[model samples]
Target: MPTPKAPVRGRFAPTPSGRLHLGNASTALLAWLQIRSAGGTMLLRMEDLDRARCKPAYSASLIEDMHWLGLDWDEGPDVGGEYGPYVQSERGAFYREAILRLQRDGWLYSCYCSRAELLLMANAPHGLEQEGNPRRCGCLYLSPEEQETRAEEKTPSLHFAMPDREIFFADGVAGARSFPSAGDFAVQRADGIIGYQLAVVVDDIAMGVTDVFRGWDLLDSTPRQLALFDALGAEPPRYAHGPLWLGEDGKRLSKRHGSVALSELREQGVASERIVGLIAWATGLIPEPEPCKPQDLIGQWTPGRIAQEAIVLPGNWMDRLR
Candidate 1:
């Protein structure tokens, strides 16, 4: 007899660097739909590790925006669950444990590369697995004494020595994908902040997340996280890279684009249902942009319906949503 599949456990981890925006809401709705359609548990995780920008006020507003949009989670920083501490900033012990294990197993090396050195290298490798942050480091070969000397000058960061093998995976939206060995990438910064690659993987493994449904912009991050999962001896989650939302300026949405900010929209008197409908229409889930609740989209959610290209919001998109 064949074994039964485990229930789907999906998650949406939002950073609190800024107010929630339309693009953020659309992604959250899609993630919620994926879990709800499959009778799975949805979880909310606060990616608030960056102390310089992420603020409690932003997180609170994000929670309020989610509530206004009719989205809820079984576990989150607000609603306690088995996963107790849902904020990444409070989960340092888990990341430190993984880093120590990686060090003991000799899978990690200390990097002392400087940004100025990176700027001088015209041939830095193309991919850093992070959008807008292309980087490559080669200090993995430094001798112990050389590293010791460098450590005396500057506190070094830990970089995972990528295993010399290709990674292959099937994405639900982007189709089959492969990546060659990327050079050493950081797992911890010199200032003791855990890197995104390490923290996200550790969180998913600990939370028992079965499916990672998020924007396609993060497609490149999978191989790096998969490698981390391999080193940590934990099973990685199934991934689906959905279409990324872009602004009228042909750039990915961010906090700077205030027109689509959810809080601004609320203050301007835009109904939550209009936002949901516009999201549904933009995602190709509905032929007409009609006002409805988040639950209305759950029953109709299908991976095939999402556009393969990035969805662009027009400069006057508010008029349509209005």
Candidate 2:
């Protein structure tokens, strides 16, 4: 008999900026299925660093949606595991320590450029406008005196000085991936909140996440994240970015695009199994759409079996539910 492999540690980190939408639900379902199918541990982490937008109600709703869909997590904010405080807002001390380490190791630099300034500079002729260019602002190579002067005028965000080289990694779904460059990205914002790139890398490391399943919209961010994992001396997790869910008009799914939020669907008497079934069919895990729970599709789930291209919903998809 062959020796069994150790169970993979996977996570589904969602931001509580809004109610769970169809896109969010599909991603959550896929992540849950991947972890559960492999007999791996699944964790839920709330990416609620943006306190100004995140709310307890939103988090509650998200948890409710997951439960309704039968996506049970082994560790999460509701259930304290070895890794307690699964919420990002509660993990500030960890982020602070990591930031200090990066600074001590000379991986972090002070960035004084505002969003507007960076946008204008990026659009300027002969400016550092190319994709993944670190010299996005004059402050990238500023002297101590110059940094001090800028600091006096505006609070500086911390940026990771990205190495100018090709980064390579293989995705479970997207296959071999390579990025020619990784632009210097922010680690901490001027408003004092840690940036998503840094926070996610730190959280994944601390939580022992071995695999990550997310939408392909975040594929380009892999290289920068890999650099952070390297600088922090933590092994990066394997990534599988699936196709995004698009509206019938072939545009990204959003409220404006008629994408139904889970809450609204629940109010409309839509069963959770119906939602999961629709997602499963859309992702190529099922021959056709039929009311089914997430568990029912696990036996049929294979990461590579998922479509690499975006799945466009029917114009009257919501009408069918009604």
Which numbered prediction scores highest in TM-score against the true structure?
A: 2
Kindly list the per-residue Cα lDDT of model 1 for residues 189-275, writing each as its tens digit: 889888999999989888889998887878888999998999999888889877888987889887555577888888889899999
Q: Write down the TM-score of every candidate.
A: 0.92, 0.93
Q: lDDT tens string, model 2, 107-129?
A: 98889999988777656665346
Off by over 4 Å in 2: 1-6, 123-135, 319-322
For model 2, which pairs clash? none
Model 1, C-alpha of 313: deviation from truth (Å): 1.4
Best-fitting candidate, scored by lDDT: 2
Candidate 1 global CA lDDT score: 0.85
TM-score attained by model 2: 0.93
Candidate 1: misplaced stretches above 4 Å? 1-6, 119-136, 254-258
lDDT of 2: 0.87
